[model samples]
Target: MDRISDFILPAVIICIVGYGFIKKAPVFDLFLEGAKEGLCTSVQILPALVALMTAVGMIKASGALDSFTYALRPVAALLHLPQEVLPLALLRPISGSGALVIFQDILRQYGPDSLIGRIASVMQGSTETTFYTIAVYYGATKVQKTRHTLPAALTADLVGFLMSALAVRLLLP
Candidate 1:
């Protein structure tokens, strides 16, 4: 299985190049064009990315995240969520890397086999970086108004967080 998986990518690449050759396509030129377009898209989204990152940094540095987490503790407790993982749950939607750092801290402090660690791990897997994703993709597409995307995506993230905890509780011994 491992050997087959290893060859899968090379096989796909070879097939693509072969097909291009058989069709007399300018594969290299096409590749270069695609790369250039990708670079342009990256450039277009750079400002959004920068703004999102700056906001995340400011929220963290100003202790807003911690305060928010603290404020949410009662709600988390009401929902039967582990208090320690609240920071991760809050951060997951905003920034994946930031959530990952908190997830890592949870794992190190609680150990992966522990219930809080399991819940955090499940959350990290299930949730999306909602704001970052919206900023990049919408920014690249020059979308000024995100009519329903924000609310829908946030609802999905909320479900993911709730289900992550519920799943860990129900499925794990």
Candidate 2:
């Protein structure tokens, strides 16, 4: 398996280059063009990434996140979910890196073998940064007026969070 994994990428590249040669395509030039386009796309998205990172930093520094988490503690308790995972659930849809920091903090606080840790792990796998994705992808494509997308993505994130809790409770020891 290890050998196959090592060989797979080179094999695929070889096949692609071979096919390009057969088709009389300028593989090197095409590769360079693609790389240049990717670099340009990265440059375009840098501002969005910086803005998100700054917002996340400001939110963390302002103690707003803690207040919000405290406010949600009652509802979380009622739902039989860990209060610790609340921030992760809320942030996961807004910023992937921000959610990751929360997720890592959870794992650090409660060892990965703990119930809360397992739930956090599952939640990370199950949920996604819906808003961040929309911002980046739609921003890149210059698509405005994201009507219904926000609601739908957020709904899915909520469901994923609930299912993550249910799954950990039912499946874990």
Candidate 3:
């Protein structure tokens, strides 16, 4: 298993180069071109990434997450979900890093094996960073409008968040 893991990348590269040679393709040049395109895409997404990071930082610094968690206490209790996991559930769709901070905090405060910690972990894994994803993908592609994508992604994240909480409560002790 260790040997296979070590050799997997080289093996895949050799296979790809061999296939390219058989097909009379310019493998090295193609690889270089792909690298250039990837760099360009990274450059295009950089500003969006900076903006997102800045926004997340401000929200965190402003204590909005804490306030939001406080406000959601009623709903969380009604749903039989932990109020401590509310930050993770809310921030997971908007920003992964923000959600991770909350998730880690939960784990630190509650211990990984605790029920709230388990629920937070499950919520983090199941949800997607919807806005961050759209920002990066659309920014890289220069898409002018995202037409219904936000709603769909948010809906999926919401469903995933609810299901994750439900499953964790049902499955874990």
TM per candidate = 0.89, 0.81, 0.83
Model 2 lDDT on a 0 to 1 scale:
0.87
Model 1 C-alpha lDDT per residue in residues 1-173, reported as the tens digit of each score:
99999999999999998999899999999989999999999899999999999998888788888998899999999998999999998888887888889999999999999999999999998778999999999889867888999999999998898898899989997
Candidate 3 Cα outliers beyond 4 Å, as residue runs: 1-24
Kindly list the per-residue Cα lDDT of model 3 for residues 1-173, writing each as its tens digit.
Answer: 99989999999999999999999999989999999999988999999889987887788789887898898899989888878788888788777777787888999999988988888888887777888888898888767788999888888987887787789878986
Better of 2 and 3 by TM-score: 3
Give the alpha carbon lDDT tens digit for every residue of 1-173 in model 2: 89989999999999999999899999999999999999899888777777766887687788887789899999999888898899998788877888898899999999898999999999999888886687677666666688898889888888899889999999886
Q: Compared to the true structure, candidate 1 yields what TM-score? A: 0.89
Worst 10 residues of 3 by lDDT: 93-102
Model 2 residue 132 distance off true place after TM-score fit, in angstroms = 2.2
Candidate 1 clashes between residue pairs 3 or more apart in a chain or in different chains? none
Q: What is the alpha-carbon lDDT for the whole of candidate 3? A: 0.86
Per TM-score, the best of the predicted structures is 1
List of clashing residue pairs for candidate 2: none
lDDT for 57 in candidate 2 is: 68
